[model samples]
Target: MAWFRNLSRFSTINVSRRHDPFLLSSFNCFSSNNINTNPTIEKPSVDPVQYSGLGPTKPHEKPRVVVLGSGWAGCRLMKGLDPEIYDIVCVSPRNHMVFTPLLASTCVGTLEFRSVAEPIARIQPAISREPGSYFFLSNCTGISADKHMVHCETVTEGEQALDPWSFTVSYDKLVIALGAQPTTFGIRGVKEHAIFLREVHHAQEIRRKLLLNLMLSDVPGISEEEKRRLLHCVVVGGGPTGVEFSGELSDFIMRDVRQRYAHVKDYVHVTLIEANEILSSFDVRLRNYATKQLTKSGVRLVRGTVKDVQDQNIILNDGSEVPYGLLVWSTGVGPSPLIHALDLPKAPGGGRIGVDEWLRVPSVQDIFSIGDCSGFVESTGRQTLPALAQVAEREGKYLAHLLNKIGKAGGGRANSGKDIDFGEPFVYKHLGSMASVGSYKALVDLRQSKETKGISLAGFISWFIWRSAYLTRVVSWRNRIYVAINWATTLVFGRDISRI
Candidate 1:
């Protein structure tokens, strides 16, 4: 037993024969003698077991690159990064990245639930093990900027509670793409009661809840008022998410749920509540078109700030109260507490980090901030970039190009570029926007000169265009196919409302 233990201990030193001559000779002496002395034996030079944890360190992998969040900015950054350049790892609780624009369609079964979600691990170049790329460390709670470390909570399989897990990763560069979280505006009961539309799980949960409400309402013992309360759905904030979700809910209720359960046709109600005018950012014609389409679809529109959100009711700032079952809060943006916690150099208006036009934090050149969390000033330095997906996407591409230049330049000169030197100082190209109303009708706001405006199409044609555009925009072919099949099947039949 002692000799066996010694032999096992000797195996641990099998790093390199040149490094540990003693153990190398002990094993090699036996093997070489057995092979060459017998002349009938052939020996292999490489053994994976010896090199399992003892292989030559491959240049320390240029330090493990940890990306926080798998949202638009994070995913785009992962996609854009050259695998040969840095060892990449994406950290987010979600395994799949939800294509938010197509998410509303998924909720209504117009697009299959699976179609709109691209697995984070499956994006192109397949970040899993492409050269210097690796994906691990999913959950991030906080970061230690001084130490250049991230504090995370992880759990084992089937574990009920999360336990603290720590890993110290030294990075040559850090990209803070944590993105923005849902803002409740200090409104009571919003966080506890309402469901947000940011992630795939949220969408799935909404679908499940809607189905459960539908089925539970049909239960024999439930009262009419209970059914009404169960059936009514109110969506707060008339931004793209809120409006589209409302439209999806309306479509599901009118087209599928009503058809399937005729008894609840009159009971189902969806209200879109916006603090300001609905889709105010869009062209007035498009806004009016969306408002009109929503109104025509039996979906009610309320304009007021949400004063308070109760479990069963919403109190508006105007002192009006509306009863509801489901509440979807999509009011506005706030800095992700993750970013806010950094307590770094902040600009005006609530600690928002003001970055230069090139998207680098003024304090730290290596730390680049983009997306909603960053307030990047335009060339005139008068207005800031709007917190839109298009803006984030453009910023991401700009950063990628800049990083590519950095890679091309190499060495000390890589870090010496002015904010405005990147051609234009983040000129936002308005590529137009689109929002669905219900069932078939949608308003496409083509604000670009190259594109036309007020393209309203209803029924199958609009639906087809919507699906095609979104599917093309989905991260990868795998997701596109998954979503396409899901949409096709749902179109032919219906949603599988059964919960797991």
Candidate 2:
């Protein structure tokens, strides 16, 4: 239908597809296709390798590994590790991994939502193959560390009332990958009024709100004041998420929205507010460049902390108010409720769950934490690594390698109960950061060391690099093709303003 509306017009690259693993992979969690009535499912044929104390990691007898939250960290670890080694169980409310870096693109019609989302089953086939492995669509509510059990609640609707909706699954090794959520910082009404940018649903909600405002602006007999309010979009928190959304919104307004709603084009506006500075996490050069680029692209940058957010307006520290049709809260991430609920040590100031360099909870063995949920402790006195997808992915791969080494070394055994020796602590290598500010303009901040300054690149070249980098990072070829086609058609025909 409309998916290929103008696809024939552009000479598109044909992406070769990667087939899903043929092995009856255990796709637990929230799959409509593959659901195990029993949490303890049949195991796939084992790798024939032998083990002591714990015995060989068979589907039934292998050390049961439970991974919480299928974000970047959990997903990668599930993919990198051998199903032949550990019986893996993954639990999360969602079954899809939202390629977060390109999420803003989806909000403004630069890319379709499905293209950027990869189902966990497709990425982590090993999890599906593991016997007794459960793909649970649920939230981990409590962890009985003493008993090595995780208390979870099934969130799926339409289940039998008499059926067990909540249960505890015992784990030999537990992984905490429950990523962070939006922090309103106790600002009044923010929790209810402002939209967050943490998940796929957040992006969907933003898209709906954005289009709704546009439609409302076109309604007859609407007052100028109401129209102004309907068209005014405010983005809070000038981090990568906020800046990118503002940029994308700016692009939508200039490239598509303005042309489509020519009668009231000038009334539509975007304002981005930050407590300190936009892209404060980036190098100074890149941050400055982003500020200038966003301003040049007609996104008003307000350097002020938000004190309170009302349904109709945002209140600033200086007591000024800015009316808005849509308010997006992209403020820094905070620990999730599940993290706080655990009786675990938290990092200072940020309240993130603390983990040793091996990504293990120092006080609790067998339970490891990673990604945004866990703060890496450095013996070198370095700051905890930034909560980034790259960092999470790297940690996952490292953890997988460690698990492989441990499985071979017989570290994960029930009878012996020996501590696994992860010889080296995690060392993070900062690659670079990039943010697009509309109109094919972007900024890139390459890594820097104490001895030398890093390289900084901006403008059209960086934008191309941004596109190429994210394109290559997408997991599946089918999704890559879909995203490529969406981008091509958008450039050629502009965004289709279909609200539904």
Candidate 3:
């Protein structure tokens, strides 16, 4: 019995060592003479010391390039950067980059959520494998341009017991690609009531709420008025996101809801409220076609401004009440609160961080800004580019090449790139625009601008082109296959309505 008890104690110590690697080393440090003979002896427990953060790189180490966000701009830059020349460190609240174009499809079961998300590790493998490169799941709180450091706090969302902790990272070059936030225009209850279709979680919430409303409206003893309000879907904004989502919702109703929830099929409806013309950026003809297409698909297009949002309905500027179970706000984006807090030079109109032709922040050394967070300085006499994904992506690609050139020229260090020639300035040429409006229909405008005359197509042919273009543009082949499979599955099996 004594030998068995000793063996049990040894096994318990071995299990503790397996759980905590440091326990084995600490146990080994105790000599036999120092070992406690009393089996009931207890030692005081001390909490483990928390890590501070990464310090400034030494002269012998590779210069660190710290990126702030994982959106289209930041992800593109990371993908194009040369890992051999510099160590990359990405800090963002989320670990994945969302494909915003197809995000609307995910809300209505046209495509699965995972198909529209690409992990940051897959985008830049060096961050996970390289000795110095890293990807921190945190949000940048502040930037110290003079000291070349950024203050960040970890994102501990959904883990109620674990409080977020702060850390600092020193960088040789800092790229600010922090994306913009959805603009609410200071409307009452916009933030609390209306859901913005930006992140993966937002789409998931929309799907869950939509499914729940559908199921609840069909329950017995529910009044007709209640069922109508519960099944009515409201979308505010005339942009591509709002229009595409309305289209997708209508498609789901016509195909899935009518067949699955036959009891309340007549109650399901989609209403799109836009103050101005839909697809305003497209050609006049394309906008007209989109309008006709949406009208034909049983979508009620209302031209009214939203005055207030309530729990179960919205008040329009004309004193009319529009009741809905689901309200999605996509009224475009503006600079985030961090951008407003930063004491940097801003552009003329949009309040974005001001950058020179080389995408470098004007008065800051070893710092650059791209994507929706950056704009050309007023002194440059250049118009601020429109906030579009294509613009951000191209800017990211250009900056990546520029940074690679600087690194090769021995300028990839703090305040060492002053003498390097930053070649020709970045020039953005408008690429084209495309939007899908359900029922196997779409619009494609290849014109450089609304003023320029280029090839513009509408109907089924453009729809094919739209799908083909985005399919090839998906970040990875893995996600491309996932999206393709999801689409095929949806077409054959109809959307997987197992609301797990």
lDDT tens digits, residue span 276-332, model 3? 999999999999999999999999999999999999999999999999999999999
Clashing residue pair totals per candidate (backbone < 3 A):
1, 8, 0
CA lDDT scores, all candidates in order: 0.66, 0.77, 0.87
Least accurate stretch of 10 residues (summed lDDT) in model 3? 3-12
Clashing pairs in 3: none
Q: Rank the candidates by lDDT, best first.
A: 3, 2, 1
- Top candidate by lDDT: 3
lDDT (0-100) at residue 31 of candidate 1?
A: 38
Candidate 2: tens digits of C-alpha lDDT, residues 189-277: 99899999878788889999999988888989999999999999999989898999999999999989878898789899999998897
The best candidate in terms of TM-score: 3
Q: What's the CA RMSD of model 3 in angstroms?
A: 7.4
List candidate 3 stretches off by more than 4 Å. 1-51
lDDT of 1 at 458: 46
Model 1 lDDT, full chain set: 0.66
Ranking under TM-score, best-scoring first? 3, 2, 1
Worst 10 residues of 1 by lDDT: 2-11
- How does candidate 2 score on lDDT? 0.77
